[model samples]
Target: MNQGTPRLAVLATAVVIGAAGLAGCATGPVDRRALCTGFDKLGSELMSANGLFDNAVFASAGDLADLADRYQGGGLSADATALERISDADATNGFELERATSGTAKVCGHPLGLGTTSYAETGSGSTQANGGYGSYGGYGYSPPTESVTSTAPEPPTSSSPTTPAGDEVSARATLQQQVDTDRTQVETLADKWVPQLSSKNHGLVAHGTTYDYRAIWADFTATRQAYPSALLLWSGDYTSYTKGDFWVTVANQSFPTGAAANAWCVAEHLDADHCFAKLVSHTHGPRGSTLPR
Candidate 1:
């Protein structure tokens, strides 16, 4: 080989290193303004998880790390640091998780609810840290007191077994706030539990404005959001959905016995006609017959 060939190789290596350095420079810190949507979504989800008392929190440890990493990359040093602690905390330690969650709430001011360990809002704005279970806020909880009230406006009670006998205004607003807040989770549950239909299911459930989601969530709050639930997202567009289309249903599997499930419906002041035991198994379709109501 020529003596100049070694120098040529050195020059090539330097060029590659210089190009890599330039690429790194080009990919400098992300704009915080551009990160607003993502940051806000993470915050909003955290806040929702914090507010929910008895449901599975959707964010995972990896999700927490992802948000934290984004915060760090986008110049939110404190928030990034706080979330890092949560991501690194002992999974088995409830107190540590709670403390970390509370600490992160103070810094991030979203999922952990500032200065509060309680997931749900009580009259005194109190809730015990249920431990970091499935994800962020509420985790596995034993049978709680049945007197739990929620921020969601309750549907007006009457003798009607279908939708409640409320005016359009009330029906329009029934659990709307709560539904909006937990919309992501509600949809996630539906996608997991029910077969997605060809047409949208919301309009089919609209009782002049009261959608099935609101009616269903109202029932869930009665059980203090214990049982897993979702709306059967079947639209009238399908010919197969002859009966009980676009209905909301809690998981029958959550209850140990069919009697227990029926008893829950009876105890919750739910209409026996609208709220009854249903068996949804694998190989089911978006039809009433497929769901043994």
Candidate 2:
């Protein structure tokens, strides 16, 4: 046996250990950006495939919850937070219309007329007679006796039944107003959150309108004003797109931490109306540098 063989074996073992260590580093936990990117992509796919973004209930898909759990386990706290927020929004579902009604309205009354009756005498008569006064003699002449008769007309009555006015038209109008307001409230709530959630989870953000490669390149160059050190490159050509000539540009900006990347996006959004950001993998190289792995 050669004395140098032992030393060579030891060196070889060291080299193997060093190579293994490099491999371990390479395979370590992915960065938060990559995890968030994956999470966002997952959510988009779920929404596209199942219409999950359209107010899907939490129980509708168990896979959503599982993906969130996986992201959380990977130490992508931001990704987990976003997933939870979006899921909560998605679980809100449709708005429930209120069944309330407006207060009762006063009814209008109608006028009524009444009649009465009574009795009244119309004519009268009297009678007289001269009798014994003339005792003996003169039975002169007896006064003629007289008779009388009378006729009457009815008087007005004392009381009469009255009818109240109707208010059907006013009541119906009020109820209709209340129903419309309830419907509006429900629709407003429905519109509020779902669109915002979709926007948050969307991966490819379209900035300014791009007619050709030059336009796309120009837009990307403008991004340098916000992310000065970012790597600017053309994304690709879309000659077959139905929306006319269009292209995409990618700005590869590196940040030390996930929070910093988010902050950069926020800051850029504040000034530029057309500026948007998307999470990409660390190994994505730069746009045009190489196809993403």
Pick the TM-score winner.
Answer: 1
For 170-236, candidate 1 gives per-residue lDDT tens digits of 4334434434444444344332232211111223322122233323333233232223243322222
Q: Where does the lowest 10-residue lDDT sum fall in candidate 2?
A: 97-106
Q: Report, for every candidate in turn, its global Cα lDDT versus the true structure.
A: 0.35, 0.26
- TM per prediction: 0.27, 0.19
RMSD of each: 16.2, 45.2
Error of 2 at 30 (Å): 58
